[model samples]
Target: MLAGIRQALPEAVCLVVDDNSPDGTAEMAREFARENGCEQNVWVKVREDERGLGGAIRAAMQVAIDNGFDLFCNLDADLSHDPVDLPRLVETCLSENADVVVGSRYVSGGAIVGWPWRRRVMSGMINGFTRTLLRLPVRDASGSYRCYRVERLAGLDPPRNPSDGYAFIQEVLMRLHREGARCVEVPITFTERRHGTSKLDLPEAVRSGLTVFRLLATR
Candidate 1:
């Protein structure tokens, strides 16, 4: 994913916020960046797991904000998000005058390939429920493949105890909307990763659903 992104947007700053993966994923990313001579444009951030996905993303956002980049993209390093879509989404946010642009799976042209029926069903149910509960117009509130305007995100104090897993995406979107960010969704086909097992389990899905309600209620 990093290689593809580097090939696509060589000038764009890419920050990799890595948790302590036992697989040495961070080392691989750094080596790739160095080998490609894009180390100046890429930075590897290591954080202990005091918080999870949401916290890591927030930390990255803070880095971007501190560095004076007005917009930044957040995505999983697992290649579920197509790096080729980055430029279009970044362009759309600037052209369409949106504060957030989501690479959506539930929008008009969006599709998910290689997921089982149960995964699809559960995703649909949870996103549908979240849409109703949060009143967010975005078709894919839980999508992590997104670009955010740093100014909008910087001004808001979003939830401190944000969900660590999939619900991390959900909370950020809802909070961005709640804080008056103009969000737009763009359809993107989500392809399953070829390498690893799914990070989400049955317990995590249920936990995400409950976490959504908890966030909605608290907000």
Candidate 2:
């Protein structure tokens, strides 16, 4: 994934946030940086503590903001998100002057590959439920593959946003919508992970559902 991104956007800086994986992911990222002569552009930050996916993403955003990056893209590292689609997301943000661009699986021309019927059905149902409840303009509220304009995100004070876990993605969009951030959705094919077990289990799904209610109640 790192290699693909580097090849696709050589000028973009890559930040790998490792949550102290026993598999030596951080070391591998550092090695990749050295081998590609991107040590100046690619950086790996290893978190000794176990922060969930949402936390890690927030940390990365903070780092990017601190380093003065104007835009940043976030995607799953499990190889499910195709690096080839990244340019399209970035392009949409720039071309449309959108504050946020989501790679939507439920949008027209978007499809999911390598998933069984049951999983696909469940995903569709969840997306529909969330969309109806939140009344969001987006079709895929749970998708994490997204690009954001740093200036717009900064106005929302991302560091102070309280959402964690998968709910964070929805929270971000909801907050951005309230702040009148321009959002665009780009169709993309989502593939099942080829490596590492998925962290999204029944418990996480329940939590995500509850998060929707929480957001609504608070609003």
Candidate 3:
């Protein structure tokens, strides 16, 4: 993924935020940066404490804001999201004047690969339920592969967002929608992770479901 991003966007800085993985992911990132001679542009932020996926992303956004970046894209490190599609997301945001651009699997031309039927069904059901319940115009509400305009995202004060897991994706979209942010969805193929275990589980699913209700109640 790091190689792909560097190849695709040579000018863009890459930030790898790790939750102090036992596998030495942070050290690996530093080694890669040095080996590639991208130490000037690439950075590794190691979180000594536990912070969920959402928190990690939120921290990255804060970094982007602090460093004066105009836009930022987030993708999974497990290779599920294709780095080649980064340009499309950014281009769509620019061409369509969108505040957020989601790399969607539920849209036309989008697809999921290497997943069993059961997993596919569950993902589809969750996306469908969340979209209907939240009244969101997007087809894939839970997808985290997305590009955000920093000015618009900064307006939301992302650090203070309540969600700490996958639910953060839904909460940000809902909040952006309410704030009249323009959003666009670009089709992309989502592949299953080739390494490590998926973080999703029954408990996380239930928590995400309850998060939807909490969001609705607050509204």
Candidate 4:
């Protein structure tokens, strides 16, 4: 994943945030950086605390913001997200002056491969539920593959989101919508992971559902 990203976006400052993965993901990324003479552009941040998707993403984004970066992009390191498509997303953000550019699977030209029907149905339901209930204007608020304007992300700096899991994706999008962010969605294909177990289980999905209600009630 690190090599692919470097090859696709040589100018990008890649920040890899790992929650102390037992597989030595952080060390491998560091080694990759050193070997490629990209020590200045590739950075690895290892979290010693409890693992949380939102926390990891927030920390990484904050680092970019504090370092005076104008743009920040994040995608799954599992190769589910295509690094080659990154340029299109970034270009859309600039062309549209969007606060965030989402790589959406529900939009035109978007497709999902290798997922079972049950998983697809559940995903669609959750996306539709969050979009309607949270009043998000975008079709795919749950997508983590996105490019965000550092300035817009900065406004949420002490991180207003309460979710630490997948719910954080939708909640943050909802919050940004409330803040009047101009969001744009670009088509992207989502391919299920061919290796490794998925962290999202039945319990996690239920929790995310409950969190949606919590957000609605709090609103």
Candidate 5:
């Protein structure tokens, strides 16, 4: 993941925010930065206090805002999202005058690889339910692979997003749509992670579904 990003977008900062995983992910990233003498652009933040998907992303967005970047792109460190598509996302955002570019799997040229029928069905069902409930404009509201215009993102204030889990994806989208952020979906092939096991369990999925309903109720 790091190597691909370095090759594709060398000038961009690779921010790896870890919730202090036992597998030493933070250590590995930091060591690589030190060894490659790329610590200036390669950053690793290990959160010792709190651990959650939304919080981690919120923290990272804060860092990007603090650094005063004009655009911010986020992808999975597990390599599920292709680094080569980074330029396309940025280009689409700039060309279309969009505030957010979603790397979508439900779009015309998008696809999901390696997931089983059950997983695919569940994902599709959740996304459908979310769209119906929240009236989110985009087709792939649940995906995390996205690029955001920093000025628009800062305007939304990610820290105020309600979800603290995977559901943050849709919640932020709903919020952005409400705030009139123009979002475009760029098709991409989403490959299943090769290394780690999936952390999303049935319980977590249920909680995320409940969160969707809560957000809709509040909306």
Candidate 6:
């Protein structure tokens, strides 16, 4: 994943937040960053609490804001999101005058690779439910592959989006849509991760569903 980022955006700064990965993933990433001569551009911030993906993203977002980056392109480190599409995503936001640009799997040219029928159903169901409940135009509400204009949404002070894990993606999308943020969809092929175990579980599914339901009910 680091290699893909380096290959795609050689000049862009990359900050990787490691949430106490027990498998030495953080160390390996640091070595790869150094070997790739991204020691200055690439950084690893380790968390001792291991809160979750959302926590890691919030931490990264803070760093981006503090460092005065105009935009942020966020993707999964597991390679589920194609890093090769990074430049296109960034360019789309700039050219379209959009505050957010999502790499959507449900768009016409988008697709999923190596996903089982059950997983596909889950993704579809979650996104479909969010669309209907929230009245959102985005096809993929739970998608994390996206680019954000840091200043556009007021830099995370927009709202207290209630989510912790994968659900945080959905929550943020909902809030953005609600806030009338202009967003564009860029189709991309999403591949299932080749490394690491799947993080989704029955409990996470329930939590995500409940979160959407809560968000909808309050609205």
Error of 6 at 214 (Å): 2.0
TM-score for model 3? 0.96
> Which has the higher lDDT value, candidate number 1 or candidate number 4?
4
Per residue, candidate 5 scores C-alpha lDDT tens digits across 195-218 of 986656677689889998888777
Check candidate 3 and list the clashing pairs: none
Model 6 misses residue 103 by how many Å?
Answer: 0.3
Better of 1 and 4 by TM-score: 4
Score candidate 5 by lDDT. 0.87
The TM-score of predicted model 2 comes to: 0.95
Cα-based lDDT for every prediction:
0.84, 0.85, 0.88, 0.88, 0.87, 0.83
Which prediction has more favorable TM-score, 1 or 6? 1
Per-candidate count of clashing residue pairs (backbone under 3 Å): 0, 0, 0, 0, 0, 0
Candidate 4 stretches greater than 4 Å from native: 157-161
Model 2 alpha-carbon drift over 4 Å, by segment: 158-161
lDDT tens per residue, model 1, 1-219? 887897777789889888877789789878988798888888988887554676788789889988989889987777888899998899999999999999999989999998999989888888888888988879887778998998888887856676777787888788888888899989988988878877667887888889988987887
Against the true structure, candidate 1 reaches a TM-score of: 0.94
Which regions of candidate 5 are displaced past 4 Å? Answer: 157-161
> How do the residues 1-219 of candidate 3 rate in per-residue lDDT, one tens digit apiece?
899999878899999999898999999989999998989889998888777887788788889988889999999999999999999999999999999999999899999999988888777877888888888879999899999998888888543438878788888898888889998999999999999876666678888889889888776
**Candidate 4 residue-wise lDDT, 93-132, digit = tens:** 9999999999999999998999988888888888899899
**Model 6 residue pairs with clashes:** none
Of models 1 and 5, which has the larger lDDT?
5
Candidate 3, lDDT over the whole model:
0.88
- Cα lDDT of candidate 2 equals 0.85
